[model samples]
Target: MSEKYLIGVDGSEQSRVALAWGLARATERGADVELLHVADDSFLSESVAFLSEAQKASEQMLNAEIEYARSLGFTGKITGNAVVGHPIAELEEASRSADLLVLGAHSGSRLAGSFFGTRAVKAAATAHCPVAVIPNNDANPNAAVVVGVDGSEASKKAIAFAAEEASFRGLALVAVYAWMPPLTPGLEYLWSEELVDSQRSAAEEAIAIGVAGLATRYPDLEIRREIVQAPPVAALVQAAEGAELVVVGSRGRGGLSRLLLGSVSHGVLQALPCPVIVTRA
Candidate 1:
């Protein structure tokens, strides 16, 4: 069977961007697209026919997107899925069997990210497969693909995904590793030069390891290595400036297994300027 990509569409403008992104990817990969719409009656009047009306409206919205996709020349099949439940819960359940879960992000202040309870963040945290969060605007195909790296299994997986995606897109791959300087109490003058050197050395080694073997796989692909002495989120987000897509690990080196998403991944998601794909093992 061919791969299937599931995308959430809520009739918002961001949803339109996500729909276009999903269809383009599906068309390129010759994979089918699943259009998911969750209708919550939270604010609707509690009438007898409200449930059916919600379901009908959701299906109609999905079909309209399908028609629009076809008009844009998408040849693959896009199945419509309508569900009545919490958006996050339904999307997470649907993403279990999907090859990828695609979502749209709202353009707003970063401070409102946590309180907004955006569906993209919550669903990406729980999805079994890789989750792609697309921005409100389209991407420039010529821009590079950026991947965050650390000496972790998740980072390794992200590296592989970023490499393959870069090769597929025929764009450069940028591997980024960040080191945070330690804060000491009033002993700044005593800080060792050797410690700084060692930290930079470790970051270099991590970049080399993360990008190992990609040169052979993609001979024509350009690879850029970046090592910055800053917080991981800051470094990765800065590297992702004007990038086509930013790929990151769901969890970092020291993240706990019980945590759905790592701190760095969440931070990058909040601050990144382009679309981000959060990969999991």
Candidate 2:
């Protein structure tokens, strides 16, 4: 297989951190790293004179990022490019041949991000390959790889991908299954111990089944499984606290009926503390 390609966007401080992380990861993987900065024409239409100046500044920023990557001991060849177009469309086009796309989350801007979602989310949903969203916070120390598995064919593919990543990075693979009580009419205020136990037991059994095949496929990799009783997105964010990377299926079996990506995967991508990888079926 060819060396993985790590692509990072340069826009904000969060993007800078993402570039640093991507550089570190690429160094470890012996992969090529590309730093891209998209100069949207719409962003510069207000001032015709400022447009040229802004483009020059953007080129400088890209050059600085490449120098920073080189300073970090990344001996592999690094390429820096600046393009003019819609940010999301440019990124999606650039990601066509990339092995992985890495992005950073805007810090303390939920409402703005929600009203006008970031380019990262759009690229992740539409990209042909996997996308990794890294948060702009303190770096995670542990090298654990957390993968969300729901027993769907797509999720099984995600599990296989996660296991391969864990093996390659020499990290522990954590397979997580989030389960909740089924909703029934007129049972809103009722608490049933039997129901809780049954759900927990079923979750454990399902996790066992999912991890068994991965364990056999990657015998040398260390694996751990967790059965959490909560929403998949919440459980995944909590599990991502100490994890280096989080993996999830692009869509689930239930969402297939409606031809939509699962809300869980979408939510996790927004709030996850570490990088997230979405695998296709």
TM-score of 1: 0.90
lDDT of 1 by residue, 1-281 (tens): 98999988777777778778888899888899988888876677777698888888888987887788788788887787887777777876898789999887765335124211355776767777898888775576779999998989889999999999999989999999998767887977766899889889988998898898999989988999999989989888889887999999885323454245778888877764788899985
Runs of candidate 1 exceeding 4 Å displacement: 41-48, 108-117, 252-260
Instruction: Work out candidate 1's RMSD over C-alphas.
Output: 2.8
Report lDDT per candidate. Answer: 0.81, 0.74
| Candidate 2 wrong stretches, greater than 4 Å | 4-6, 46-57, 107-117, 185-201, 252-261
Candidate 2, position 28, lDDT: 78
lDDT of 2 by residue, 1-281 (tens): 54556565565667767777778878777788777877767646757677777778779878877777777777887887876667767776787778887777764323126212365666666666777777777766667999997888778878888999999888899999998787778885675787688878888887887777666677789998888888888898899878988899885323342244468777876675677787766
| TM-scores for candidates 1 onward, in order | 0.90, 0.83
Please report the candidate that would top TM-score against the real structure: 1
Residue 138: error of model 1 in Å?
4.9
